[model samples]
Target: MKNLYDLVVIGSGPGGYVSAIRASQLGLRTAIIEKYQELGGTCLNVGCIPSKSLLDSSKYFSLAKNNYSSHGIFFEKLFFDFKKMMDRKNEVVKNINNGVKYLMKKNKIDVYQGIGSFKTKNILFLKDIKSLKEKKEIQFQYCIISTGSKPSCFPHLNFHLENRILSSTEALHLKEIPKKLIIIGGGIIGLELGSIFNRLGSKIIILEPMEKIISNMDDSLSHEMQKILEKSSIQIETSLSVSNIFKENHEQISVFAKYHNGKEVKFIGDYCLLSIGRIPYTKNLELENIKIQKNKKGFIHVNDDLQTSVKNIYAIGDVIGGKMLAHKAEEEGLYVVEHIVGKKPNKLNYDLIPSIIYTYPEVASVGRSENEIKKDKIEYNIGIFPMKILARARTSGCTDGFLKMISHKKTDEILGVHIIGDHASDMIMEASIAMEFRSSSEDIYRICHPHPTLSESFKEAALLNFENRSIHM
Candidate 1:
């Protein structure tokens, strides 16, 4: 009875820990389990936080090396300390990890460091991660499974960290900058890491199996991003299916691929990074003991209320498989907690969840894409405004990318907003909020935005969508 809880959350990732905090806030006796020595999971430990830290450091170095001269600022013998950059990133992650620990203590949520496996519908056995020996048993009235995901590797290739074949995790902690890095996937992870090394003076070659990089985004975004990256001297090879990856020697690696017509090619590099995607991590949860259901892809099955097949057990985040973004998982975690408390919270609006890629120019989008709108056979009006034409872009000298807005043809209601430019990550909320309130193009256009700002592009695009004309252009 001392080990009993109203809710037990497995995994201390964004979803798991956040849910536990929320449950505690709502007066539910809660406990959270994490296998790792640290809290915050992948996003904090090796994913978003560290990647962004490196990105900012690399970007600053790049600006001094490339752009500063144009602004009449010059530095003699410019150099960057790669080790210091990595140290800062590690420190940032450590601070956040401690912050999460503090939150758990402040909320009075019991934090168990071990693997939690379901012993029965109402109980779990916590086992030592290394020895796999049972440490303790936990009883709960309800459980939330927030175990996140891991990076996926090629099915045919046997990958090892020592072989120079790396996932995002290994890529983030390299001892030295690679002279040549070959990336196997051109999604967010690949492009972001590639951008970092390319800025730091590594030759980057991105091989994407799809027709375009970031193929899941809007077509305009994919095309424009590819062009921008190419201009930065990052080589992109699309429509090439990789057949084999092997270590050529202690100092080199090779990746083999073929064209659609079967022309074979070999790419050699010091390091080969696989950034294809991620798969649900449901390992060691012992779901079978409780007979909870999962989909073919190993994602836990959740109904409309995010309840698993076993009603008392619920799952959220990457384990349930939707966007897999940290914020998405956090929202799901909050929703699940609120639902458990008998609060009639609104169902999550998946469409309004914005997607962002933190490349040099950045990319963000909300609501339906142009292709999705077309596929749905919705009559729509589109407006595009180039960044180069803006005074703010000229001032900042980052004149690459554009803002595109789509609206219903008859009603003039905004359908989607997509942007690729500086500060686009933060700028996307305007569109998301607009779409959340079902605002029309006219509404955005009428809202006064400050002069000479990146966000003005949004207003201009809205005006163009509403009346097929923009004042700036």
Candidate 2:
């Protein structure tokens, strides 16, 4: 007799592990498989968690060195230990890993430490992660593939992971911060990681092929963030494409690129950090065996219900190609499990999902950007508030960003919210909740926000939307 399950979720990431736990809660026998020995996928292991940990540490160091004197606090000699910072980050990650293990045990979900492959629509084959040998076959009623993604690299910049070259993964675990760091992409990962070393006293240079960093957000955000990065002494070169990388010496790397103005550009650095992006990682799952339909970019195809060509098999997270946020994956996991138990869950709202960049002053948004509204030729009202005007922001000594709101001109319903200020990631949730209930700008303005807090910016922007102005702004 073979082991059986009502659900088998592959990857054990935010999507996979969450779905397996939800399945168990619904009284379904569940199992989860992961290729990595430690759980939490890239988000926990090497991506979000570790990166944010370093971001936090670097932020504190930056504040003590730069802003502490403004608050009348002086130190003889302030210093940071890179090794100690990394050790603490590892501690935070290990604790979360234990928490995930506890959840799996609490739900009685069997966890297999190996890669999962499809044997049939109703059967799964597990392979040893190290040896790549088939370990077992399990019968399952349904399966979910949530194996996330890997860092994307360009052909010219590609090299073996070693001392000089690095992906975002290797960037996190570098033994020493490079003196001159040249980053090739200016997206979320690039900006966040660039800030980390820039604050650590590195001469940072960022080369972005696009016109702006975090270009997917509102143009205002892109412009404001660029100013902030430049204020921190990080060089940002936009509209430039890197053509080649050459090792000038043992520790010197030269990068060659073409500027949008048709001029050749060259840069020399101690290390080159590649933060281009990531792609779905499913090449080895033998998805071909199941004949799963993937688009041109290799993301698995799924219907509205997240079901593949075979209805019993579902796909979610980065593997399925929507917004690649961890929270997005978690929500989809919950929805799919509820769906499996004959419960009709609410549809996943990709638009309302908040996207965040965890820099010193975070960037977060939900619903739509002004660019999207303009493209559709919608009548909209806009409200913009600078963080410098807020009392809380001034007191905090970090007033380098702003919050903008967009609402329907006639109906007054809030269409989108963009924030780049203190606690923007946490603050955006209020907008998310409001948008979830279809709250109007006037509706948000009516709600009482506490005095001398960062959240007041949201309400002020809301007031500016319909009232033509705000008391503070």
Candidate 3:
């Protein structure tokens, strides 16, 4: 009984730690298990936090090297120290790691640094991460698994850090900026990492097997973003299926691919980054001991309440595989915690959870995409306003994208909002809030948005959506 807890959460990523904290707050004796030495998992350690830190640092360096001159700001010479940027990124991650540890202590949740394996529906054994020796046994009335995901690679390719076939994790820790980087797959991970290196003076070539990069998003977004990235001198090749990747020598890598029409091409670069996708990390949990059910994709199966086949156990975050966004995982963590406490929290609106890509001009969308609405066969009206027309855009010199609003033709209710522009990541929350309340296009149009702000574009788009007219254009 000494090791018994009301709840035991496995994995200390955003989802796991957050659920543990909430459980403690709800007066449950809780504990969390982490296999890594550090507390925060991939998101804080590598995926979101480190990536954004580098992104911001690289963006500043780029502005000084290219854009400041047009604003009457000129420097005799502009230079950046790549080492310092990486140092700052590491420091940021370290601070957040310590912060998570402090939260565990503050909340009085027992922290176990080991791999947790199920022994029964109500019992788990913690083993030393490296030795695989059982260290302790723990019991819990309920359990939540949030062991996230890892970058996936092709079946034939073996990733060795020395050979420079990089995943996003390896790409983040490069000692030097590559002279040329070849990126396979142009989803959020590939494009984001490519943008970072490109801004830092690396020649970037992106090969996407699909017809468009960011293919899951709105078609308009794909078209506009491709144009923007290409204009920035990043080479993008679509409809190419990579056949093989091999090291030509110690310093160079080669990628061989074929086009849809069967034309073969080869690309050589200093490094090849594989960003095809990620797989749910459900390894070493020994789920078979307890007969936990998982789908064919290795993601644990959970019902409407996020309950596993064994009702007392639940799974959240990338292990269960939905959006795979940190925020989405965090929300699911909260939902599971509140559900356990009988708080009866509102069910998550999966459709309204926003998706964001943090390229130079960010892309974000919430609610249904235009294509999804079309697939549903719903009658809808569309309104689009370019960001360039806004005075705020001209003032800031960020005039490359637009805001598009889709609404029901009959009821006038806003259905989806898509944007590609400055602050698109932050700007998307407005649309999410509007759609969450089932607000109409006229409602957003009538709301007063401050002048000389990027958000006014939202109002203009809403006006155009409902009335088919815009005040600015």
Candidate 4:
């Protein structure tokens, strides 16, 4: 008799593993399948976790290099070991990977070490590992497809398989920082990774095809980030498209680009980091074999309950698209499991989800941007507060951006909150929670926030929304 499960989640990413654990907690026999030996998918293994690890380390390096003297601390020339930095990142990742493994054990969830795909609504096939030839099948009452995404490869590059040309995964494990690094995209990944290596003394240049970096974000926010990057000595070239990439010398890389008007420019770098973004990694699953469907962008479509077109199968995470945040995937995982267990989970508030960019002074936002509101012709009140006015930011000496709060002018309901400054990622959660409760700006203003803290920015912004009176601002 073949093995069976009440729930089988493929991909072992934030969605897959969390769904398996939740299902097991619900007293359902559950299993999770991962292609790699390690359990956590891209978020844990190569993407979010590793990126954050490097971001933290690089931030420390930046602080030590730039601000330590201002704090009345003087030291000899500081040095950072690139190999040690990578080793530390690997150690953090391994620890988290082990934690996931331990969670599976504690939850008594069976973990299959191979890629899993549906053969039918209730059946799945796992490729045999030892023989590398045989196929094994398992039956499940329900399944979650959490197969994540891979870096979207640019076509014109001829695809450098060399170590020097790296995706996010390869970039995370690099032993040495390239003296000159060319980043191919200006999205979150490109900026975050570029910021890291640049802080570590790499001459970094970000090539973005769009008119600005972080094109999906508010134009003002993108320009703010561009200014910060420029101030940090990172060159950002926008409105440029990559035509091709070729090898110049054995070590030097040639990048060819064309402007909007057919003007061509070339750049030579020691290494090229491609961060064009990622596409759903559903190819290996042979989704067509079972009639699993995907969108035009290759993302699998899922209903509010995260149910796929096939009733017994579901999809989540980067595979399902949106803002590809790990927390979003984890929420979907839990929500889907609850949905499977006969509980009608609350619909995910897509607009309320927050996105964070781990650049120097982190950027985070929830709900709509002012640009979106204006585009929709909505009458809104925009409240802006410079982080420099905040006591916390002045103490930290890291005030580089401001918080912009958008609210319905008539209703005073907080429509959106966007921030780009110290601890913005951490602070945005409060705004997200408020938005989740449909809290108005007046309501947030009524709630007393601790003074001399970063969170006061939220209260001040809220105050500014209704009345033009921000105490500090």
Best by lDDT: 3
Off by over 4 Å in 2: 156-163
**Candidate 4 vs. true structure, TM-score:** 0.97
Q: TM-score for all predictions?
A: 0.98, 0.98, 0.99, 0.97
Query: Lowest summed lDDT over 10 consecutive residues: which window, candidate 3?
Result: 153-162
In angstroms, give how far residue 322 of model 3 lies from its true place: 1.5
Prediction 1 global C-alpha lDDT: 0.93
Worst 10 residues of 1 by lDDT: 154-163
Global lDDT of each model?
0.93, 0.91, 0.94, 0.87
Which wins on lDDT, candidate 1 or candidate 2? 1
Candidate 1's TM-score: 0.98
Q: Which digits, one per residue and each the tens of the lDDT, describe model 2 over residues 1-473? A: 56799999999888888998889999999999988889899999999999999999999999999999999999998999999999999999999999999999999999998878887888888888878898899899989989999888876556444648789888888889889999999999999999999999999999999998898889989999999889889999999999988778788888999998999989999999888888999966888887899999989999998998889999999998888889999999998899989899999888898999999899998999998999999999998989999999999988989999999999999999999998998999999999999999999999999989999998899999999799986
Q: Taking the tens digit of each residue's C-alpha lDDT, what string does model 3 give over 203-285?
A: 99999999999998999999999999999899999998999999999999999999999999999999999999899998889
RMSD of each candidate relative to the true structure: 1.0, 1.2, 0.9, 1.5
Model 1 lDDT tens row, 360-421: 89999988899999999999999999999999999998999999999999999999999999
TM-score of 3: 0.99
Candidate 4 per-residue lDDT, tens place, 10-59, comes to 88988889888889999999988887889889888888898999999999
Candidate 2 lDDT (Cα, 0 to 1) = 0.91
Off by over 4 Å in 1: 156-159
